[model samples]
Target: MVVDTEPRMLKHQVVRKSLDSLLEGMSPGDPFPSERDLADAHDVSRETLRQAIRELLVAGRIERRGRTTVVAAPKVVLPLAIGSYTEAAREKGMSATRILVGWSTYSADAELAELLHIDTGAPVVQLERVFTTDDTRVGLETTRIPADRIPGLIETFDYRTSLYAELRTRGIIFGPVVDTIETVLPDAREAALLTVDTRTPMFLLNRTSYDDQGVPIEQRRSLYRGDRMTFTAVMGA
Candidate 1:
């Protein structure tokens, strides 16, 4: 008697293999075939195809642009260190450009006041900017600084230039910083600005930079595109 006991591959695995075959012929930013088409072509269930596509998205092999999925560019690796975004991109041989989106002085809210160690209602400068590499927008950075700490900052400082360099020239020095990283989805406005879908995942970094005396000088919230950027860190053993 002949027994047929060979284990068959899982449906999602088969779908993944088919998708790999499809990707072999595609270039970065090239739109992938529609989900229904892929499912039919692979002879797999729609759920299985979606699972495979989600895996690809998580692995950074593909990204969703509006309603279509496309091959993604290699992620730009950035070291988790204290430095300017411009300098970091330059180290990787990419031209970094900063565009100042807006700036205004406002009364610190409860949360902002606590983060900056200032009293609520104290004046704070809110600065928003976008960072791009090779003309591709990659990150959005919003910073809040105690207005009393940087006199004439709103009127005299060039918001389009390197803020850290400007602060250094003004005798403001950086000390230790506390940073936290999280994953988030872009809001509608952020999606429009980053040219990504609202559901696209991103890296949100919250950092508080301190002065030499350990006083908080600035609180920064930065959103980086997950498909376009990666963060690395080196630890001593």
Candidate 2:
């Protein structure tokens, strides 16, 4: 005789494990099995199978494609350090590119002045760009820098080049940076720009980078697709 004292796995949990295996062998963009078909194959009710599918959806292993579900591409992992987004994508074996969407000069408001350690009404250049990885839209970033700091930046710098690299060419050396991250819902404009559902959660990151002399270099705000982007950090005691 054998004894089994452990609690049995829930039906949905069991189904989820099986589905994970199926996803492992599936290619990105491949259609996921329909709910009815999955239920029949797993010998479970549609509602039960749905619970399992929902988990995968939230985990970014699958995504909604019109009326069907499809396997999703792997998420891009960003390190919690001062570096280039393109470099991070390359480390993950993904191609990274950016498009300049908005660029202009504006006077710093009270909040922006405080963050940039400049007087209110100081002129600053703002650059808005969208980033893509492996042909998938991944994030939008807006960077503001004091206009006087990077003279001729608007006319001389190439938007397609790395912003950090451009700064280096202008004799700007990066120092320590402060970063803040949060989960948020994008507004209509942002959702449309990213081609994501308004209800989809996003990761918002605000960063202020300093120059080697401890002067503020740039203030940047970035919104990353929750399903397509992830962040990693190294901690020491």
Candidate 3:
């Protein structure tokens, strides 16, 4: 067994370990013991117990549900590769769906023109979608596609299905993608839409997908709940 001995043990660390052990006997959504009871049982001060609980909350091991603390569902692992969110959820034995929060078509401004490598004022379809896994809202995605490449996409596309799947049907296959991630906090509007507090941490991901000829096919920005999602990468030699 591996042991963490690098950092000298702190008072809160001791309590956190004990609480982690207690959680092994518990299941997701199970109510955690009251703070007072946990402090007494762990022989720690209330402040120390709260500190430990705070650590667990940040680590995604536990979460606040209404006014009670409960064991959090295991974070969904997203592969850092060219695949859709639907595939990732499916691998975790969960159902994936999305709600189209917004959709519009507009001329590609300078920023969009640079990202999509298109001329300024080119038509682009902008899609706003909220991704849900097992009934939990986990991510918000905004996708932009050059309208001229995929004719009639706005009229024929199904908002409920995977965007990648729809693109494949129209002969647009993603070859390689570049993804960047940043840690950020949500704004009031984002918080309300995600059903999370403004203080909740989020993973902001910007991705650009390209076709075989090195043409940018799609540009997407997605925000994922840090408490409910994790990323994994595969390295090759």
Candidate 4:
């Protein structure tokens, strides 16, 4: 015997349609009505309304800021390419800004040496910066490069601008880069820098770049706010 599934499906569809209609009339960062009020207006149970809201949260249409839920800005689509983050934001019609937090030169530890293909105890330059679009903090990036590779880079180059451009001028163009992406919860320091709660999820991107001669040039670690960024990849057979 076939079971009747139309009623349950109809409830879900109706709840989704109602929420979608509500969203169409709301602007980004606008407060959403209370669940009880929305349920009453949609003539659906509270559970049904909650399920619809959960779907919207997963779709990045809404977010919880502090204690209230509000409409979310469109997720910035980050392409998987070897390019400057500033250039990427410009392509999306957004102005990108970089704030240098600090920089220093240090002796490479074993792990840093392995990542940059340098000798342990050799000098390396470490630079930290926060990336923003307009006034919204989007990401935090830390990069390490062998000091010997780019002499005077720490003193001569402006950390607020694109490092790739400066490296290009010095004939250190990138040939290939390997990227690994993972989801992580921010630590207290990271949360403070990104202006998000420690419990908020983030995307951790670790990348290593090599020069034309297969020499590792730089290793970068970037943490992007999950609520503000989405990654897209193109795959082929």
Best by lDDT: 2
**Which lDDT tens digits does candidate 3 get at residues 47-156?**
99999988888788998877888899888888878878877788879999888898899999999899999999999999998999888888999999999888887788
Each prediction's TM-score versus the true structure = 0.84, 0.86, 0.89, 0.81
User: Candidate 4 — what's its lDDT?
Assistant: 0.87
Give the Cα RMSD of candidate 1. Answer: 4.3
* Model 4 ranges with Cα > 4 A deviation: 1-21, 34-58, 63-69, 235-237
Off by over 4 Å in 3: 1-7, 40-47
**Which candidate order results from sorting by TM-score in descending order?**
3, 2, 1, 4
The 10-residue segment of model 4 with minimum total lDDT is: 5-14
Rank by lDDT (best first): 2, 3, 1, 4
lDDT at 218, model 1: 95
lDDT of 2 by residue, 14-131 (tens): 9999999999899999999999999999999999998998788768899886798899988788897887897778787888888888899999999999999999999999999889
For each candidate, C-alpha RMSD in Å?
Answer: 4.3, 3.7, 3.5, 3.6
Residue 221 CA displacement from its true place in model 3, Å? 0.6
Candidate 1 per-residue lDDT, tens place, 161-226, comes to 788998999898889899999999999999888887787789999999998999998999999988
Q: Rate the local accuracy (lDDT) of all candidates.
A: 0.87, 0.90, 0.89, 0.87
Error of 3 at 140 (Å): 1.2
| Candidate 4 lDDT, 106-185, residue by residue in tens | 99999989989888999999999999986678899999999999999878988778899999999886898999999998
